[model samples]
Target: MKANKETKRLFVGGLGQAISETDLQIQFSRFGEVSDVEIITRKDDQGNPQKIFAYINIKVAEEDLKKCMSVLNKTKWKGGTLQIQLAKESFLHRLAQEREEAKSKKEKSTTGNTNVSEKMGGIDFQMKAVPGTEVPGHKNWVVSKFGRVLPVLHLKNQHKRKISFVICFSE
Candidate 1:
């Protein structure tokens, strides 16, 4: 029996944050064989972690892809809604190109500023304190602070050091 195009592998996208590869495989497996699954992540301006999306590839006839879409489109998973559709060859190609472009952009930004600059609201500090000095603590500071107290290193075996502190703040 010849395989139907509908049963061929199709790509699914617009995944929610809580969706996992295993969840996708299990969910889609009910309709057809899931060949592969991938979740995408990206960082925001503040260097915070963020989930971009996900893709699922199911092995089924072409008609099955449509069926899958109809069944799964606008579905909710783990409190997140999804946008499912048949992935055309051109769509996959476009995704690959976009990924490459994103990678290149990241590389360029790392090597040199790529005009993707964002203002950082706060500052970071590394301080070395004397033995007797007490670091003043601030309340309700504009920026969040994280500090570590460490033994200060002695220079030329001269003076005794108390602590070395490192602090970071976010505005």
Candidate 2:
């Protein structure tokens, strides 16, 4: 995605304590119109402020933004390798995206009998069953299917002809 269309804010890292907002604006204005520059700082243990990083809001063409990021990222400036990246989307945007994903997953889950895999946080949960098995509600077949992953299995909704379970795995 293009930086100009997605976002104009850029996260800048590895800035020195001596650098100022105007200095950052001067360095970034070579490629585009820098609308604003913010140098973030935090107090150290000794009660002295230290420069952590900065954010730059620039208006530029798509190609210019790409070139600017390439030229500035990892470049040595003020005795530190600069790390430049497109800042993350706002919290509202992330929440909206998550809600949309949940809606789609809910829709997919309401369909016919099939295997479904879901990832939440750092855990993997897979719901599956052997369709062509002769014996109904066989736990050995289910365990054998996921033996490679060393799963922690939880069986539920058992019946004469069908068995549903959840298999969890950690990476």
Best by lDDT: 2
Q: List where candidate 1 sits over 4 angstroms from the true fold.
A: 1-11, 49-51, 88-171
Q: Please count the clashing residue pairs in each candidate, in the order shown.
A: 11, 0
Model 2 alpha-carbon drift over 4 Å, by segment: 1-7, 90-171
TM-score of each: 0.44, 0.48
- Model 1 over residues 1-171: C-alpha lDDT tens digits? 875644343455555566778987898887777777877767689976564466666667766666767888888777566777655655556656755775576556643453321122222222343333333452212221222222333234246644433244233
Which candidate tops TM-score?
2
lDDT of each: 0.55, 0.65
Model 1 weakest lDDT span, ten residues long: 139-148
Looking at model 2, residue 59 earns an lDDT score of 83
Q: Give the 10-residue window scoring lowest on summed lDDT in candidate 2.
A: 118-127
